[model samples]
Target: MWQIILKRENEISLSRQLFYAMKDMILEGQIRSGEALPSSRGLAKDMSISRSTVNEAYDMLETEGYIVTHQGAPTRVKEGLYLEKHQKHHEEALFPVITLADKPYKVDFKTGQPDVSLFPRYVWNQMMYKSFEQLSDKDLGYFGTAGYESLRVEISHWLFRKRGLSAKPQDIFITSGTTQALSILVTMLSKAGLPFAVEDPCHRGLLEVIENSGNSILGISVDQEGMKTALLEAHDFSAVYVTPSHQFPLGSILTAERRIELIRLARQKKFYIIEDDYDSEFRYVGASVTPLYSMDKEQVLYTGSFSKTLYPALRIGFVILPPKLHSEWMYLRKHLDVQNPIVEQAALAEFLNQRKLDKYIQQISRMYEKKRKALTTSIYECFGEQCSILGDETGLHLVLKIPGAHFDEFFIEKCQNAGIRVFPIEHYCISKGNHMDQLMLGYGHLKVEEIQKSVSRLYNLIMDTE
Candidate 1:
């Protein structure tokens, strides 16, 4: 009898273990093709298992075409079933997974980080409880891929009041976050196979989504007013992605003239504009910058996220899609995770209805403004006239530009080695060498004292490097 071991105490059934053992032996050529397997009754007697268990395992092997059974003869291994055994490495993992705790930086200026401590968790919990209590049987099942109607309506209202953008509840499709929205949009729009256009120095993670789809990317450089729209006239694109509200890394608002120009070109050239309204709400300056979506709702796909406003784990965002594109968007979204969870959507709806989010934004904006001021002040104190801050008027982060200073990979590594985590603007650039003298500093999650101390440490590191 072939050597067969069974562990009755194991959670796996005896039959499964036997099947796996036999299959391995067959593949490893220990049991050659056309070789006869022992009869079920005899194998069961040898292994001390029930006759039925052996039959079940044999049945599986037969059904899978790994073995063939004839009514009057023994089960025989199928032809071409044998596979050479490959050597297994027993070495320990060379690269251990690094987590947030691994690289303990004295100060980290990671961008797009929000001060989660300022979020009203108790209020949100109460809302969540209410949403759960009110859930109907229908709510637990697949709600529409478009998302909860109540949440959409509330979002519509919030958009109108805050951004002055009038969007119908039907047009607003709820997503897990802006990242999901971008991924789906990239797929939907890139069907034409035309190159996708994005800011040269754009959000790296979002850029990867488009790049991963195997679509050609056109990197349009950005100036103080935003994307260099003049360069766009030369090429045909499937879509153009821009952060008009608050340009990432550089922190420049796309001027009204450029916004109009983009809309015009999108209309003439027949390309969709992706407006990522990142960090648009917490403007420290005069007023929150109007979204490019407001200018041309039909031409622009507007995306917004509550991840920075609330907590990262909350994972709620939305896109205001045009009506003509809705059916296709829904089809793509249905195949990609169907829809978001109902409880969070319902809870967020209630939160919006009660004006809690509006109040929270107002409260948090004040605190963020203070942190921004402190960060700028500290930078001035440390680097003096050599360094100038950009994009402090809006967003949780700003760019620090030092003329004649190259914040390349070596500098970034050196800073990290010195217990500081600061990101250079060039890190996010699609086409490098354009922005080599700047660094992005996120102060939203840091306390005033932490900001000051981090700036001092950053200055010391820079001075040492110089």
Candidate 2:
């Protein structure tokens, strides 16, 4: 008798279990070629299973070519099925586990992360539940390739009230986030073999997305007023990506004149512009700058996201495309992800309609403003005249420019070894050595006390290095 066992009580069916056992045996050479399988009735009696179970298992094995059966003859295992085990050197490589202590720093100045502790979870949860309960049958189904019409309407209103940018709901397309929106734009706008221009020390993630899509990228130099439009004029590109509201990492708002120049260039060159209006909702100073999209909706593609404002996991963002490009965007979006989750879209629309987003931004903006002040104060107390903080006016992070200090690979490794996680601006630069003296610090996630400690630690580390 074959050593076949079946457990009818297991989650897997008896037939599947039997098939697996038999297949394993055949593969291991236990059941050799031309070996006769026990007749179904006999095998079932021996294994204490129904005869039909055994028959089903045998039928599956035969159907899969694992075994061949001839009428009134043995079931033979397929020939040439055994795979020889190859002998090779197996080396266990030990990689160094990077710990914060290895760098030994008191303060971490990473940027872009928001303080999750400050989020109004209770209110958001209530909205989420309410929206879920009110969802219609049609809402559960694919609404449209564009987005939830209600959410689009609300976003249009939200942008106008918050950022002073007026956009039509018809022109808006929802995406997972700004990253996905930018990614789709890169694919949608890049003419055959044409290059897209981006800021030199731009957001590294956006740069990677454009490059990975096989689109050419021209890096334009960025000064205090954002991307030098003069540099852009000299270059020929299909599209130009700019952060007009507030430049990332460096924190410079694109000036009005340059904005006009960029729009003019795009119109003249027959190219498009991608305006990433991220983090502009948290501006503490002058009025939130008007998005470049307002200047010329025809040629500019404006992208915004809720990750920084609401929460990162929400994964809700949108793009404002011109009327001409709407059809192509819808086509690409249909194939990309089909559509975003309707529940969140419906909930977010309600949230905006109730003006909760405006209140939330006002609340977080105040909190962030305090954190930014604390960070600047801490840096001044520790570093004295030795260091200067850059771009402290806007955004969640600032650049600490230490004079005569070159933060190269050796310095970065040294900081990591000390438990301090600070990013060198050079790490973000496409062409290095230009920003070697600057370190990017994000204070949005750090408490006022943590900021003080981190700054003190960084100061001591810098002094020791000198």
RMSD (Å) per prediction: 3.7, 3.9
Instruction: For residues 191-272, write the lDDT of model 2, one tens digit per residue.
Output: 8777888887888898889889988778887889999999876768878999887787788889999999998988899999
Q: Give candidate 2's TM-score.
A: 0.88
Q: How far off is residue 228 in model 1, in Å?
A: 3.5
Q: How close is candidate 1 to the true structure, as a TM-score?
A: 0.85
lDDT of 1: 0.90
Off by over 4 Å in 2: 1-15, 25-35, 40-107
Off by over 4 Å in 1: 1-9, 33-80, 85-102, 118-126, 129-133, 191-194, 231-236
Measured by TM-score, the strongest candidate is 2
Candidates in order, TM-scores: namely: 0.85, 0.88
Relative to the true structure, candidate 1 has a C-alpha RMSD (angstroms) of 3.7
